[model samples]
Target: MMSGPAQKYVYTKLDQIKEGTVVNLYGVVKFFKVPYRSKGTDYCSTVTIMDQSNAKLTCTFFSGNQDTLPKIYSIGDIVRFHRIKITQFNSEFLGISSNGFSALVFEGTAGAPALPRTSSKTYSFTEEDHKIVESLRIWQMGQQTFSNLRLKLSDIKPEQYFNLICHLVGKAVLDKACYLLKVWDGSKCALPAWKVCVEEEALEGDADFLSLHQHLTVDVLVYDNHVEAAKSLKVGSYIVIQNLHAKLHNTCNENQAENSYLEFHLHGGTLYGRGITILPENDIDVQELQKVLTTVNLNEEPICSEDLTSHNRLSQKSPPFNALERCQQLSVTVLPTRQEWLTTPLSTVVKMKPPQKYRVRVRLRIFQPQHLYQSVKLHCTKCSSLQAVPDEERLDNILQGNYTNCPDTDAQNAYWYQSVKWKRNQENRTVTIHFMKKHDMLQIPQESLIMVEGGTFKEFCKLSRKFNSIIPVTCNQANLELDLSAPFLVQGNIWHYGCRNCSSLKSIEALSSLTLEGSWNATEIAKALGIKPLTYVFVMNLTLEDETGSLNAYLWRRAAEQFFQISASEIFMVNNLQEQLNVIMTTLCPPGKSIGEYPWMDCCIKSYHSCDGREEQNLYEIFDTLIS
Candidate 1:
């Protein structure tokens, strides 16, 4: 018979019971068998029971005084065992013998509370209970314990007994009979988290497997019967796992040298006594762990595989070479004439192999030459040391148009240059010309008759020839004649100046419609238009169409402000600016009109020579007062 207090029978939950501990627990009998002789030595009987926590425990009793326990405890009867020896068999269970001082009492009388038998009862905890659970000391990675210890992914060592917490960032990849979960936690190394390989049976029978599939809140992929308690969990649910075996896996790549990471398994070893326990998210330990995780900066963590590979590549030693030598090794092609190269579209330039050179006649028309040049210190590429160059002397030479006297030595190299942006082919183009041994600056005012040789490297196009590579060549602007007698009507979608050639005209009056392409943020719009910082500008692309042809026009801030009757700053403040711009475009260019008919508006056509020295034209329609 039970005495002392009724609560004394509430020992630790079956999952929390440690081996060698004398426990007094109350559990409802799930299964029971009459006493029978094992090897004809002593009578034995087996019974499985479950507590309010839903933890199952199997009780084995041997003959003597305890022989009547199996007969007294029937299925669905709540029984109390006092001082039973808690041991681990397939999992944690209890062992009792008639000779032992253990006692059993039935708690199914009218005085006891009626417990549910059809389903597992969830054990509720009070604040005091939560405090007690939190205060319990659990084994950590570096500790030696009777049971396996919990470890962080970084602390896991090869052939060690450990478990960890990780977020499942990828789908499980099945390899043969095991499912591998890719996990990661914000740690030092960029290596993938310990690979958690779960057996097929463990995954299929897990009740939480269905919940995990339905609501992917929990990042950990659990594989054991313990997951039955986590069926209510969802993705992002913080959990603590215990008792897993860790083994180191090598990539077997010679280049990867000694690189290795850990892999965790749930089965195959007695060291992991109870297989694995996936704690509920609300568990006190898991809540504490969640607090620790909140401080980790997962965004900056190096979890990208590509970044890891790149880091490995950079760690290796490499050689250095001169810029000219590097250029010589690339695939360089020199076209015969500028006309052929000019016909090559910008898209083609983007796809072509780098270090390509072209010989073309380019007119030099600097937009703001004063802002183009700046004094900058040069450095020796090999030693990474600054090279000494008198800035005043260099400026004097640049002004005098005698830029060829700069000295160049093995130890020191002087590279004084200016970046000039200018209008070419009615499009903006920029080039940086080094004033090394070239007097090219003198031709700036002359609309240079000299041949221009340049190269394209990476994203930079039309890189001017360095001082040492500049050569004098006799070339003239190709004579281009236009046939404008018969009016040249419409062609396929708006003709790109670089793609199609049109007859040069001073002005044209056309009935047209305008359609807004789109609007972008001020900063992004500025970047796309190559507008300098601090320059107040709002820009958008508009498609102007007529029965004859169409053109994609650039509407700068000044022109857009006049046409829209609002300041650029005010236009940016409109919440639905795109829709507003479309409305304006529709008013200017009414849709569904006859192919070539609309209210006639006079448009001034401007022409400029392209890189090939052939004229390209653009149309500008400004609302200016008509001169009487």
Candidate 2:
């Protein structure tokens, strides 16, 4: 980051940085923790940076005054750190402020101002340094969603962080270190948002408008160091709350968590870059947020929480502007309800804390299960699980191996199913064929479900040709049992598979409570019997790229079905449907061609922590999108 003699003096590249040496370096801000009052006297800020080499460095800067710290407003902003020591910490290299360390920041928008945002009026600025910043700005435009972190309230999810640009309508002092800031961003949160009551109250400009539209307002609890910042914010002024924590209220009673809901908590510390940063008049996002506010329905009737059912809470959200038109252009899937949030960058999408949704635009890079046939899988709804579609040949071997077990009972007289002896395969006891006689067809109806105790897979196939479905089972101590080795249910060449560790077997008697139709409803029957019916579903990892970045998302389950306009079952059962899927895939990412050949899709995507809370499990998921 310093101007120097051509070819004689070059600023240190982040990749070429050496430990123990102090050097001036420039990098694009990948992430930054806002300057917060550290445990010590200094204000500390943590920043992660990268260069064209793709080498990233995590650096910490400390200053007696917060203003002197690097002014990083966005993710892709350029920064020049002068005189920082490169040291190894916890086995990873880190940049720490050294003697005489000074920082300068620049806008990352290409062709924008190259002037540095700094406290110092006088600093080295030359043609070479200007070119370096320009080069970084140009490169960052293609990296990803590095422009902004602001999010609408409607898209919030629990246990995540986001930046909110909103009008401050009301404020109330809570406890000594906490303040409740009631604000709205025109949009309404899908999940129930909170409103806190305090002894004292204050109101102003936007309060009356927000009071009428109480449902749109969200209670933001600003705590500790952030309390001071929120106190000065005037009602009706546009403001941005940085690193706001959208979390479940921790005070809810464990046994009775009915009161537990999502609350915006601006926790005391600035460790993860928390706190309010800019005003409405200064930032660009607030300008658009202002436009959304004007669109709020002022004449709308206000309803209390008790009056509004959960389904009607967020009756509607930002209406998709030209969403139909955009979908028709190239999007494979579109949100059920048209959405207003425009397409976000993939890089920005990845940085988002989970449990929320966003609109994004991307082109298919590649799809997993390179052999498309392998993409079809059987998914269990009860306990989320995916397994390969059961192979008939393998299942045949399992049924033949277990046919010797005497699994039938004579007590079938009391139940809807009646037991009968098979003519062959009499290993020890007679093979009992428990026939569900409710079907109106012949004695052994094709629409019925048959449970057998002793029969080979071949014999079951012979019976299934006449009957539509058959389950091979055993009786143990008056209890019906199913070992997971073979298919739980077999219909011709089709086999239904379940989970390895999550499934527990229940008896056919479980279905006795439900009324039967002419044909068995497999999903309803599976639910009744505690047998997870496996439905063929598409589960494939896809690489979606845009000018900013690439995101790898799972085109899975209902999302996949909607995207293809063909159910996984239809694709699995019909050859033409499978061929149709191939044509769609080929269109999204054609064979042996440049990326420019791929089609673009305007989509809705969600990013979040995985169920198990594993960091690696955090991923981007394609949702509310369809391939047309």
TM-score top scorer: 2
In angstroms, how far off is 564's CA in candidate 1? Answer: 85
Would you estimate the TM-scores of all the predictions?
A: 0.26, 0.43
lDDT of 2: 0.69
Residue lDDT tens for model 2, 424-450: 545454666777655322243644677
**Local accuracy by lDDT, each model:** 0.34, 0.69
Q: Show where candidate 1 strays beyond 4 Å.
A: 1-148, 167-176, 185-234, 237-243, 253-259, 267-271, 302-306, 310-628
Runs with alpha carbons beyond 4 Å of true place in candidate 2? 1-10, 98-100, 110-115, 124-130, 144-149, 200-206, 232-238, 248-261, 294-628
- Span of ten consecutive residues with least summed lDDT in model 1: 490-499
Q: Give the TM-score of candidate 1.
A: 0.26
Candidate 1 colliding pairs:
216-235, 217-234, 217-235, 217-236, 218-234, 218-235, 547-595, 547-596
| Model 2 TM-score, all chains together | 0.43
